[model samples]
Target: MNEILNNLLSLHSESEIAEFKEARNSFDFNKLGKYFSALSNEANLKKLKCAWLVFGVKDNRTVVGSQFRTNLQDLQSLKKEIADKTTSRLTFVDIHEIEHPDGRVLLFEIPAAPQGLPIAWDGHYYGRDGESLGPLNLEEIERIRRQNRASDWSAVTLPSASITDLEPAAIEQARENFFQKNPKLVQEAKQWDIATFLNKAKLTINGQITRAAILLLGKAESSHFLNPASATITWILKDRDGLERDYQHFGCPLLLGVDEVFHKIRPLKYRYMKEGTLFPEEVEQYDPYIIREALNNAIAHQDYELGGKITLVEFEDGRLCFSNVGQFIPGSVESVIQTDAPESRYRNRFLIDAMVNLNMIDTIGSGIRKMFLIQKKRFFPLPEYDLKDNRVQVTVIGRVVDMAYARKLAEYPNLTLEDILLLDRVQKRKPLTDDQAKYLKSLGLIEGRKPNFHISAQIANHSGERMQYIHNRALDDQYYKELILAYLEKFGTAKRVDINGLVLDKLPNVLDETQKYNKVKNLLQALKQKGLIESEGKSWRMSKKI
Candidate 1:
């Protein structure tokens, strides 16, 4: 344990937690909140468990520790001050005191930023670029505040350098992709030299080379700009329960690493019903759209400023989890998918620029939104975000997940993205706010009392019987069509009352007496119009089409 602590001894850097170093050892209450918001949000973006604010540390990276104040009251005071300005009345877990053999350390372990809302510092939002905190640049701030965490990261480039240092192979690939994306550039493309093209591609810094230059074009061994932090993505295959089964790591030039990590991520064959039909159809376990967005977003948006690798975990039961080292810039997944707004900025401009030029991701703010759209079209559970320990974790269930649940969700097209995000929290067995629980109950998706929610049996298909679905479909307009056809083929309908009795149990799960009565009335009217079944006074009989 001490050995682990020994390695962590040199971990006073703000990049570790997304928190900033206070130029002055003493800062007031509002400033404390600002640091918490800055560090916590950045931690989530960086994908770390916690970002920290130490009382004593030299700019040179030495752990001098502090002597200003070490009393428990002072530590507790920090939490109260932050709570006043933040939503959810946030507070730190604890202000830690670590006495190294040489110096005394005060580690304020800030939690991850709250999901669905940006951590505003005293009514104003804040953000950090590297180590500096400003008014949280509007473009980048809005993108993250709305949960566009999957926005491009690689487009950000080091401003001081140009294209000369970029690798030739990566540049050549970029040019090919550019010509392919904009075919009109084909004739003019050949006319421009590499430098002119790189300039046009925004891969160069005013005709100079940048660290981003080395990252994308420099040899694998030439990545000195990102010292300590490796620009590598590691894929780990796992079983259904998340136990590791296999692993592989990938790195720049990103053009190759992106494809390498993708190949390593195992895709499974899957099947589902067509939107309006009830039948079997197949798609890759990992939606190609989802997989591409996730993989590219991880590369484009990762905070290489933090020294860690992006992780992709593929589970046997058909779930792929993509995580990277950085706080989720778009704050929460809910806001991103719900709002129709565009994201303004990214973390890795250089990397994202290259991907955009390479046709890997959209520079406009539609990445996560598109991911949500694809999942919804497939009737899949929405993606989830885990924001504890200062890191961001996104989990996408790839298989035909919970058919009944998917069907029930399809029934309610009005369900809000916020509600889905909250349900995701519940499914993970994480604590939900009272508002969240109330919302679930209102939708009849959950039952039972506080602390224990039994998914409504109707939606859960608790009996797990195909007959339950058969009966349930009898009452749905869409399902009614199928049943009318099925029932006529099985037992020629004789009495309207009999057909209602046959499907009464299914009605019990979904509706009250009035809804069931109305459903039966509607089905009878439709069958008669279709000339399949007609009512003779109070009785009904099937048409002798044969």
Candidate 2:
């Protein structure tokens, strides 16, 4: 710590990659976030591993004490707060607190912006012009964004590994899949040796094994060939409460491990009645194609350099979460779904190509969209994506979350995939942006205000969701007031508990217990304000005016 601080202090002034702040008592959070963005972007542009933001320091290199976030808990919480606002939730590598002879110094170690992604704070990109902080220029942003263009980690050759390092079984399976994919070359491929076949299949370069080969076909014991990068996939079976019931880790060759991981997941049967049929329809909890596509996509796009294993978590509630370490290259799932086209570029070009050639995945970039379509067709909730924390996680819900959503899909076979997606969000109670709300509202398919929307009455009637809609819909306040007045007239007086017992269950189910209580309180207050009811020592009675 002392060495690092001395080095920073040795600098005559703050550089592009370092900022000094004399937060003697406190510091503005917005300024701190801006510095995080600027320092991170500057570090990436300078090709440095990290940047520094030192507290309790002056621009002239004088050390003064800082009382910023004196509490350790509050100081540590800055990581999440910063991540909440920064692009990809990028945060400090580590925060170092130093007790210097001159004062208490704090060092915030900020990692460089990731390749292809410039750090943005609250939607604005920031950079450093010497010591001055400002918006990151277009050229600098493009320069950082273009860093990913030439890098292909999977295509890199591993001279240390050879055919002997790969599993014979996995290679044979690959040959079979490849033959199926390219039947015209079967006779020609059959005559070729394994080395020639591997080269033709794009798994190797000039008879030398590549990381893609190691990941897809390397022997389990040969995983060490990748060194620091992991060629592993972990499958965890969790109960409804999220407690791990069982777990198993499978290593390369991932081609065979995919099947092993798939079998570990129990895709139980899910039964739901068809729209009009009294009989229930039974289907596999998860579609086999969805499972393979998700797993293969994870393996194909995983940031192996991150040294994190791909994880597939199966919950007893009939959902599977497939996660891989890396950013979703296409940026957002909506872009992929909306465009329904191949991505312009990929992080693992070599690996993806090899997998596509083997028929393990499609190159059309419709895999995720296909997953959504399959879920929609089955009347199951669409797949959910959580693309944050420097990782891409996709959750496939096998069972139906809301019968109303499934019924809606079943009855309205003509509904566009986009409409189904927005409806899915409504069923999940996720917040909808203004445009989304406006579009849904314009279609007359939803009701209520932002964030508390419910299926409109017309759709609810046609979809057999009237009961659910009623539960979500609040009755008119006048009706509730009338009920209260009638109760007071019949009972003469009503205690708070009595009023709650009368009205709590009557309120819309969309409001939680707390909200229900608040609603009852508001109702009584409104009546009191109108002079229709009066409070008499913790009880209520009809007012003389009424």
Candidate 3:
């Protein structure tokens, strides 16, 4: 039954589509309704005979059986529940249950809403932008409604496909990378021939190459699998006037085309100052580690399921912009930047893990944090992010900020990690939270509101003689007795309260108010013992310096 059911989930004969959910506990009624409306509309638009929603797959896209919420009859009401809430009675065409060996699979076979019919949820028109369910905008709704005139890329498999259709070199590279990634499977994987390897990699079907194979490892000529537009990366170099100085299209066999994109990028030398000096300490403009991490992250995590190409743009103003065709699952850039936590949802789980195991990216979520930390340490502004046009664009600034300001930031050792990140935001003239502002003020460090703050004037050298007179002198017993004796020698007396003006600022941090008073009292007693000063109680006279 398990082998028979496994055949039910294949692309060649898929009775159902697959999706992973750790538990049905996460099912939000409202969102699920929207997904049904959108996915159904997409299925209709793409002319897929049916679309499916399955559950219980893990991050590696493996079917990890899940125990669904088992008020079994309760799920039957879902189709009617969605139709009643949606506009124009839009809903699942049908919902079926299949009992597999491990667990049950719920199949929602959704018919296309209709040609030119826009599907809506709760009276709002809906559609999919990749895996997301969003209320349909006028343009997207029209695009889907008009374009449902064609077939989807996923449903197509090249019929004449064979191992000869794929690039031998690219396939070899894939095997080397895969074997290197799964060391436990080293001997098993090594013994397998090319046909066996291709099948195992999901690039082929039943030992025969398919469209996915041609796309992943095909030679330049076979890139027809990427139809309409070619599988390419376009690099555009612009001048100060926003005119394109140069443009090039990188082609197939992407195992190597990716590196060509890298070679086209140039990161220069950056100069930053550590002190109040004229010269700059030199560092690479773009940290190689960070740029590589960002680029590979874009490539690995992008929605290849969507047709848009990953983009890397080099600007004249010393910036590298990387844009991937997908929605950032983490929501906001500030949320990710300000907190030191890892991501909750990944855009492409399988591809990201593959890249991770291959050492293209590290798994611990340290790379992004390191990028911010390194830039902050160098007093460079933190990286910026923009999500627009259904794409995630990250801009990494390569220039340095003012040297004098950077110098001051380097001095403070008591600063917390969060404070450093916040200060970088502050220096960028960005808004911060109330707790963040309060934290800085409590340190007696910052003075102004919001975007403006500086080292207090009291700490600055321009405080002149007042600070010096305060900083240089001391109120110790020996110094006081000397003062008293000098007074007695020259003028014969010293006033009690007059001694208060003698010294104070030279006191150390270790001394408290009570200890300070005791020290002063002890000084007076020692002066009396040496006959250096005569305390007529309130008034004391100095004798001489001993």
Candidate 4:
């Protein structure tokens, strides 16, 4: 520790991966977190094992002493506090308190941000411009993220773990699935031994059990084989209010754990009236294939080295959210959906290969696109992917929000998947980019202004949702101008609040409260510009010209 501290002190100034802070008193917790993110990212960028955040050191290499977290217990507790806000809950590797001759120096050892995953503080990525801390640029973030493209953690063989650590039942299931995936191999596969089958299946490297093998086939007690890494999937049932109702944790073998988690979810019967049917059509709230595909994807892509369990949250309102700790390698969900080709890169090539051979996942990269297609076919909202916070969370909505919109999806068999996705965004009240809005408008598929767009009137009328269309559709600017003019004519004067009451509710429901408020303000401004109405303090009245 002394030698390490001496080396850092010998530096002329702080570098990208080494930062010196002089905290003669206490340091701000938020600022400390920012430093943690910056140093961790710099370490990854510089290909260093770890970075240094040394306290009690001035910028000039002077040890002034630090009173930050003086108490031993409080100092240790800083780990959890930093983890709570950092990406993947990453914290200090070790905090060494060295009593230097000059003062009490503290050395914070920060591990490099994991491959393909950049550390973020409080939802933002931070980095150091030499010694100065700043937001990590996109290129740097992508550079750190691309580091995992060539590496496969699951491909690494476990030296101490063997086939004995695997569960017989899981192995049997693996054989069955493998044979099912390759019917021609069924006869020959039966003759092969467990090791031979595992080797052939790519679950083992030269008959040595790999991390992928342990995760899919290892016995529950054999989880320790992947030290500092976890192979557990947690399923939680939540009510409408987001409170947990029940929860269960499943450890490897993850093949069966996927099933256990699936069964735990209650996919209720969802009944909805078809366009012209008297009796409602009933379907399962969630599709079995969708559930398995999502769960398997989570397991396959999870950054196990982060030591976090895959999470499956089932909401009573007919939604399933599957989350795993890792960056989405494909970058954007749209790229995967739009492109028909398979992904050129994968984070866990061996695990994905094993899963593919075991009939768990497909390598075609169409799994996510298939999820979206399945939801569209079932008249459900497209699967939503939240790829923020260095994690991938996919939410599958099992029920339809709009019957008309859903029927329209089935009605227009030629409607492209991209079109349906854009319409799905509209139905979900999600904001659209100008290009998306313009494309939808050019096709006459959507109506209304920006951010307040709704389904086109033709579709609404055809689907018998004219009332909903009218509610979402905005009135003409002239119509709103007339309402304001009539109000001021009858009342002589109207306050901004009074004007809001007159036209706010009349505005389209598609516009949110803020948009609605902005609409009213714009109307007042337009009328005032045309010399139709004038503002008097906070009130409005008919203009002298009018």
Q: Highest TM-score, which number?
A: 4
Cα TM-score of candidate 1: 0.54
Error of 1 at 532 (Å): 59
Would you list the rank order by TM-score, best first? 4, 2, 1, 3
What TM-score, over all chains together, does every model reach? Answer: 0.54, 0.78, 0.52, 0.86
lDDT of 2 by residue, 287-330 (tens): 99999999999998887755678999998988899999888888
TM-score of 2: 0.78
What is the per-residue lDDT of model 3 for residues 1-546, given as tens digits with 9 covering 90 to 100? 344335445534222132334343446777777767776666765667556565554434355565565566777677678878764455665666566565665555665654445667777776666555566678757865454234323224677766776788887788887777777888999899988876666556576555445655678888876564346667777776677778777766665666677778775787654444423578878878777777777765555544567677788777778887655766776676666576765654544544554446666666777887777666667777788644788888787664433544555534565677666665565666788788867866444544444443333332222343343224445665566566556765557556655533345323445655665677778867766566665777754444
Q: Clashes per prediction? A: 44, 0, 2, 0
Candidate 4, residues 1-546, lDDT tens digits: the string is 999999999998899998898988889899999999999999999989899999999998999988888999999999999999998889998999999999999999999998878999999999999888999999999998777876889999988888899999999999999999999989999999999999999999998899999999999999888877889899899999999999999999999898888889885899886557522488899999999999999998888768788999999988899999887888999999899678988888899999999999998878888888888788788999999877999999888877777877866767899999899899889999999999998988898877678899878776677888888888888998899999889999999989899999999888889989999999999999989888888889999985
- Candidate 3 residue runs with Cα over 4 Å from true position: 1-160, 175-192, 196-216, 227-230, 273-280, 334-344, 412-417, 443-445, 451-546
Q: What is the TM-score of candidate 3?
A: 0.52
* lDDT comparing candidate 2 with the true structure: 0.89
Please report, as a residue range, the 10-residue window in candidate 3 with the lowest summed lDDT. Answer: 11-20
Task: Rank all candidate structures by their lDDT, best first, as comma-separated numbers.
Answer: 4, 2, 1, 3
